[model samples]
Target: MALTDAPVAAKSAKRLRRQPLWIIYGFVFPAMAMALVFDYYPALSGLYLSMTNTMEVGIQSQFVGFSNYVQLFTSSIFLNSLWHMLVLAVVGMTIGTVVPLLVAEMIFHLMNGRWRYVYRLTFLIKMLVPGMVVVEVWGYILSVGGLLDKICHFLGLPGGSTGWLVDQHTALPAIMFIGFPWVAGVGILIYYAGLVAIDPEILDAAAVDGSGGLHRVLNVDVPLVLGQVKLIVILSAIGGFQGYFAQFLLTQGGPGWSTMVPGYYMYQSAFVNGDMGLASAVGVFLFVLIFSITLMNMKYLRSSQDYAGQR
Candidate 1:
């Protein structure tokens, strides 16, 4: 009798503890509605808009199939901009991905004391400044007679008074080299977290086996932080496509489209030229490209993770 009654009371208590479905829905409804209205609606509408002949608001919109995309691929200016964007993306990703990992390794190998904290803080402080401000500052720096000018004069190299940002031959390269040394705070933080989270015994064991600094870093440190490296690479790739704010704000696609990226091209099409359909088409292309790259990166990261787990 006691056991039967105990089980009955436990079940009753569990039933009593469960909340009503309406209450859960009440908590979730607002968020779901917001997502549908703000996120999904815009995405779907943009997709629909990309296929239409919409120029601007108050203008007649008509379905025109893939004409906008055809126009985009056929335009020499757009094609040139695409080439420039590719160059920027490749250079930016290589520098942005590799440099932070190196910086993180340097900081991680430092004596785990005041110096480590100081160094970490020094890099992370870059995150304090607004991203827009950073872009603007770099824009100024790359402008005529900016910081690069002084450095060029110091090094006895010919510094163009017209600035690399405006020179047709150097505009893209200037954008590529904006963040000198590329010690991005976010990358440093992510890589450092991965490094610190590593088991100390693994590193100590490497040292015990007569593994010196370079050997340990090459074999142990880098391999352990593969996940972080993968993450930064994906982020850089996505940023490569979407991160054209600098070009938009400063260069304005100047010097005959030397620094123009697809993102900035989209903005120029939609806002400046009032070609809504064309801009939406560009947006769609960028979204697809970025999505594809992210998926590939994720797949690679997963396989690497699996391999690491096997080892």
Candidate 2:
């Protein structure tokens, strides 16, 4: 009887331990349900809609079965837009990632904490302003006889008559340069946090060994913060690929299609042309591209072990 009772008590204790886990699942279920309803449902619906010829609402649409994709692949405009997006993603990621890192390093090395906070708040305040407002303001600044033209005139340069946003040559560059002197608030904060997490004793040791300035940064500081750098790189790539608001608000794909990107192409297909099926196909392409690259990044570019191995 004692042996049987001991086994029963052990089983009871194990069941009791699982009760908290069940409660946690109960607490999390509603939020999970909401995400499925709002986010995942729309994505799945888009993929389904991509298979049909959904020209407009309240109209009978037929199943096309990959015709839209075939048309898109053969379209020169779509290929050009894709090339523009690739260029924007690479250039934007490089400048956005590097500039903020340098700024964060400058701020972190400041002797006065108060000044550091002040500079941080200054950059952060720009992010608080509406993105549309920023784009509109830049539109004005890049237009004919705007800020750049005025500066060019002051410096005795020609081409003041030409608009930056209107010229095929300058339109893309103008869009990419909107956030000039890049020092993005979020990027700076992330890099600063990475710098802060480094062991101070290691820095002190480097200093004692005569490591200074660029040497310390390149060798010790950068290696220690490679995890954050990798995270920023991956996120920047994703954002740059999906981002089209600046192009939409500023160029509207431009005097020509010089500033066109994949995101804006999708937007124009759906809203301007009212071709929902093609738009859905574009969305699917974007989803697959972003998802595939993200998975590859996670699998191959893991910063923790990669940087540790660098040592």
Candidate 3:
């Protein structure tokens, strides 16, 4: 090619590459706007508010410079709420991760395609139900003379009419029992997708080697889905630390703070007690805790091919 033609062709290629830059920015603009407005702005504002003694609106609250955080750490009520959050995180993460993996494995092994689809549809339907509706149904089930009491009546057990959400000893446990089976629908789908991604030859080799059932699951399947497990674990920990929907709906952190989780405590501080500064401080603490734990997990408990290679 001539030198002039070469330069022209190069310029044309550069223009073509630059042409799509505007389209990319156009597509990304909406998400960027949303993050700035909803996520980034609120986070920055909350952090600033946490350092002040702001309670009521329109009155200039003086900057207290970490006093809110100090109070949060020293308060017995906050400490109790932190403990409750930790327990819920542990229990929820355990059942949320393991149960869905088991369910997914069972579905993956189903011999009939129709039956497998039916099972998947059923799990999906559970997820279609709104979370608030589920909490309300559980609240009714725990109410006095509700389904629980009827079950106890069938067994001739006295004191079955006890108020589950109103008793200090039972409120937190009752909140935890809302999703009794604990096989989250989305979790099942994720694990199943991970299992489905495995090469068929790998499974055939396992079967040929006489590795099936529990032996196959522990040695082969589990390692294959470690990525899914790690994903669910991280998600569950974040949700458990931030979630208080059930506690708020069913118990309202009642029965003398027995069910007071950190999220609800923060809510009460802001909306109920008019202590926005403290609530903001709690929010900051929760953000740090989740960020730190997630970083540690990503650093040490990586979901990589090393374990799969070992297997």
TM-score of each: 0.90, 0.88, 0.87
Please give, for residues 115-222, the per-residue lDDT of candidate 3 as tens digits.
Answer: 988998898888878999999998888889888778778898764456788878878877888878877568898888888878899999999999999899889999
Instruction: Give residue 161's error in model 1 in angstroms.
Output: 3.2
Q: In candidate 2, which residue pairs clash?
A: none
Best by TM-score: 1
**Which 10 consecutive residues of model 3 have the lowest summed lDDT?**
1-10
Q: Pick the candidate with the highest lDDT.
A: 3
- Model 2: residues >4 Å from true position, as ranges? 1-29, 301-303, 306-311
| 1 versus 2: better TM-score goes to | 1
What C-alpha lDDT, on a 0 to 100 scale, does residue 307 get in candidate 2?
Answer: 50
Candidate 1 error regions (>4 Å): 1-17
TM-score attained by model 3: 0.87
